[model samples]
Target: MAPNSSAPHTPERPGTPVIPGFAHRRVEVAEGVALHAAVGGAGRPIVLLHGFPQTHLMWRHVAADLAADHTVICPDLRGYGASDKPAATGPAVYAKRTMAADVVALARALGHERFALAGHDRGALVAFRAGLDHPGAISHLACLDVLPTPDMWDVLHGRDAAVGFHLYLMAQPPGLPERLIAADADAFFGHFLDLWAEDPAAVPPAVRAAYLEACRNAVPSIVADYRASATVDADDDLADRAAGNRLRMPVTVLQQDWGAALGYDAAGLWRAWAPDLRHATVDCGHFMAEEAPGRVAAELRWLLAR
Candidate 1:
């Protein structure tokens, strides 16, 4: 469905940091669901998806820079930020497959049938799925600081898996995860915001507060999003893997030396899924878009060139 002008406009929270000139919009991508996005720039379009515990604002620096030439879109994935968080009535609702379709629908609703796609953290999972499921719709793909779902599960075992303990925490069946997270939403979500960034000041106080606020209000949907990953999302990836589905477009992956720390070849895993791939290790932390926006933007420009 196309964007519904009738859909209520979602106002930015007061003092919420924004991409200088980007406009906020609420675009309905499915029945009773609309994604909140910050859209700006004006040329070939590229959509940027945010990761866990962060919103479109995470792309503020990169989006503004990209807007100089390319139309840049940064959206709160359905369950995050100000986006509508319909109850996860079933598994598919919060699955990356569904979120991937939401991205494609969002772009089309804004008048582009095909556009480049990039995602960070959880968003990267969605972009990965989008590239596999809607190969013709996504012109280029860039993933930051994450592994594919099945590979992510495969890599974690023994003491090494402790780094991702939250994955196990949130993946539990519904009630307990939601209750535990909501009990101290800030502490739960803020833990990642604090731990993931190499430069803590990169996120600053105001933006961090915004993220915490968003996560606090959307705990259930957030857990549902993660829960979907542990179940349906992994199932989807397994099916894709068995069928040998690969991303057909030019793909770029940027990450810190996770392979060294996690005891896996990150690039090799990405190469199995993306035949046309360029994988590099960055010197910064997980929040590379915030910590090193210039390099992230440059890499995206390179991907667009291909």
Candidate 2:
């Protein structure tokens, strides 16, 4: 169900931010859907996935730094950024498994059989699934600021769950979430951009405007993506945990100290899934790639060497 080439591409909106050295591409990962990726550099490939409320642009700093050595491919996840927003006909359409498949396909399409992978927030979930479901294709994995879907649900209770209110909102049956979010997409998406950054200046005015614009235009698909996480993605993670499935690749996890606030060991939780894991708590906010690109890039280089 690929889109008609005649249908003018609308995802990469006018005034959308761009990474200076990277070349943008609309690569078809599925029959009908093409992912918008910013690719640059050479040598070994390392695909970087952007998180929620942001696009490949979030990786601008890190991607530029990594591109100096490794080939860095930054794609806006399917339902976000400039990528196709296929209707979520079923949960699988937006499931992490499916998204992971898209990532593998995108890399293979770019001529890389296997690549190191890293993702932030929602993208981390996709990278996690890619590591588990496509173990042979991912050489190394790094997840920033997110836990496995089931572990996330398990760890939140009472007031602690307030931090994830949007998860519950989006988890509800369709209609309402999309309507509510679309009603004030800017405020809804901008809230996180404001709330999650440790250094507000890290996300400059132009980048912030770009993120808001992307989210404003993508309310439905974005909601579907989150909705799948609460249902199918959670089920997938639980099934894997029950079957003792673990990531076979070398793994690195960088997260804020949610453990202290939420009463769960973030590193311990990640270790259960990634046997060879290196988890560290960072001082920055949720947008670590933008907030501390140097540290993030150094950690990635270390992971690549392993």
State in Å the error of residue 94, model 1. 0.2
lDDT of 2: 0.91
The whole-model lDDT of each prediction reads: 0.91, 0.91
TM-score between model 1 and native: 0.97
lDDT of 2 by residue, 1-306 (tens): 243222223334566678887887777888788888888999899999999899888999999999998999998899888888999999999999999999998898778989999999999999999999999999999999999999999998999899999999999998999999998999999999999999999999999998988899889899999999899999999999999999999999999999998999999999999989999888999999999999999999999998
Q: Which portions of model 2 miss their true places by more than 4 Å? A: 1-11
Candidate 1, residue 133: lDDT: 95
Model 1 lDDT tens row, 1-306: 455432435556677777788888789988888998989999999999999889998999999999999999888999999898999889999999999999998898888899999999999999999999999999999999999999999999999999999999989998998898899899999998888888999999989999999999999999999888899999999999999889999999998999899888999999999999999999988999999999999999999998
